[model samples]
Target: MEDELEDRVLHQTYLSFMKIVTRLTSSAPHDTPVSYLWKMVRLYFLRSEVAVITLGIILFIMYLQTIEQWSRTLLSRLSQAMSPISSVQRMKFMEGSEADKQSWELKGSLSAAYAIKGRRMHMEDRFIINENINNTGISLFAIFDGHGGEFAANYAKDHLIQNLYNKIVEIDAFKEGKIISTPTKDNAEDKPQEPESNTSVERKISFKKSVSTADDTSKKEVTDPELLAQLSKARPIITREVRPTKPIKNVPVPLSSYLDKGKINFGKLLTDEVLAADRLLVEAAKRSMNVAGTTALLAIMEGNHLIVANVGDSRGVMCDSRGNAIPVSFDHKPQQVREQKRIEAAGGYIAFNGVWRVAGILATSRAMGDYPLKDKKFVIADPDILTFNLNDHKPMFLVLASDGLWDTFSNEEAVKFIKERLDEPDYGAKSLTLQAYYRGSVDNITVLVINFLDNKVASSATQ
Candidate 1:
């Protein structure tokens, strides 16, 4: 039994020794070729992942920097574009106006030309107003072009309509006062007193007057009662003579009647007001350092009457029911022969190859402001106002736009485009302006399209 226990203990010791050898071989570090290849492969993958993460971080930072730079550039461009008309300005008479009582609706759009580089720039400005009073609707459209700088254009855009409003008010006041009669030394004393309120004044006198006169100076020859019997026997040899008649004198009608009869005297009013305003604008322009000036085209539609006032090169186009564009405003520039002749007659010489410049200072013969050239006697700074009554058909659309769009498209072309787009279901004024910008208009383009469609149609179309 002792021998059997010894054999079993020895077998146990041998098995324990073999287990210790196996553990030592497994724990020992090995440098076998296969193990080294596996370690190399694992390290290579880790390095690649770290490299990709580092590259991704770098790209993200670059993207952020690029975005920041791009934002700054865009903001700078916008700022430069708006630099010219940054000054504070006010309109002359936009306040205290009654809203339109009519049911008509008005809509408009505007755009700037393409971006320009450096000091030279192109810009546009526009204004529109709709007024309804006593169920009568009035719409006003205006465009202004800034030369030398956009300050003048902006000023005109903000104020020209107000000036027209003031002029209209003046006209209303004149009509209310019955001041149509020419002031004479004798009638001056008999003139009616000014009424406290405009509406309280007496109705204006009839423009026409009738004249009647009678005189009993002479009669046909007649024989006396005693001689009548003798004359009858004498074969009635007496003859009768009559004096020649003279024309009766009639009183002249009052001038205001012409205006009251739907004849808008825009020419007279614009002549008076624009000249005065031109003088003021010239003075103000002189005070400014950059010699700012504006080109203006203004239009007013009242009933069938269309009044147009223009200065410089801006334009007003009228589209009839047939979709034909009619130019209402005349462009005033040095290149016009009549303007050139006027300039030459006034002792002003044309420079730059007969461009009709005033002392070689200005390119336009007629403009609102250019104090440097104002001293020239021949320079026409006053606006030309033209008025006409439309045929029974109302205007389909009236376009008031800056020169940016006009430079590329003629009045007819613009009207045609607007008309064609009008029929499209999704057409919009803003979209048309954007398309203009896309069509190579490199300046600030502003367009005001007045559609006289019904409210429901306009609302639906806009939607």
Candidate 2:
């Protein structure tokens, strides 16, 4: 009974107070209302000093909340800048556009790929299928498997191809009319640019072409002959070739190129571009709270020539004319002798936990991002580049995929599976992912199959 009576009295008092407040605001002088409000506020809260303390706490919490929200928005904007889908949508806005036509034209060559977020919370893999790049009859297909997040993969997919194309054009490879013909000549010359994955490379490429200094005291110069800045936004830039200080000749041009005496040294092109992209991407990632890394496996088909650049565990295999499987990319594992030695040289170690991992955090030794590891040289982004001429190998089809698919399928097994289903609408890409999922694969699965039966055959006559 006492509680009910107290509640009723409090409610009545509140109603009377509101009426007084409304009346005073409407009729009383402004100064009078201000004084009245101040007195009323003191009268209500003076009974308990705890009320003032509580109000102060509430205001401080609100201030902190505002700051946190503002920071979240800022981080999101930076993340969006890494790979802006809105910009792409704006560029390719119309249907049946040039980009669309080119995409279909490449699809007509019987290339199909599919990605699925299988057994993973978020799908981090990204892939690209582009054809007739710069009207040079060059087609590029790539797969990027992200480990920690998708930012590194997406950034690489957006910038690496453009950078590589600009580098190729910089060399006058197409302007000079160097055709890939039989009895090819690979000058085996040292590239006139900075070394591949030079440790001292500035982690940043300028928006405009500018000279980078190595040491002010020594007066040494480090220049990217290609300018190394190929982002679309950078329009006006200059290019100057400096005599290279380092010579890269240790890794020989691979088996197919040597056997056929391949002409162009695409190795240098892939090396320089991938290394530059990795450095810039690392810088971008370091700014964010989430630092990631990705494996890159890229294939460039120009005329009769095919060049592949690989970093990490993603695999690419081709079916030769004899129906035998030929690997195009090699996986980088921490257990490998060379990789182990490099890790140790950099003051890092690898441990086996179901699989060999660099620093027990990453399974692949070479990847695009993955911060402080890259700083310590415990992990590198240097790619292994290999070249082949389609005329010499006569590939029936090629299969490229992330390690998820390779975990359950071998090179021969994948080639035979695709060969049997070459006529399928998806060129066996969908089926391959499904098969891997069924075969106990636990990671994200992505597969690409390019059938060469319908593609233009490269021969000496065509050249």
CA RMSD, predictions in order? 28.4, 20.7
lDDT per residue (tens digit) for residues 408-454 in model 1: 78888888887776644322344455556656776556566655444
Deviation (Å) of 265 in candidate 1: 1.9
Residue clash pairs of candidate 2: none
TM-score of each: 0.52, 0.58
User: Using TM-score as the measure, which candidate wins?
Assistant: 2
Instruction: Name the regions of candidate 2 deviating beyond 4 angstroms.
Output: 1-108, 168-264, 454-463
lDDT of 1 at 101: 14
The local distance difference test score of each candidate is 0.52, 0.66
Q: After superposition, how far is residue 118 of candidate 2 from its true place, in Å?
A: 1.1
Worst 10 residues of 2 by lDDT: 209-218
TM-score of 1: 0.52
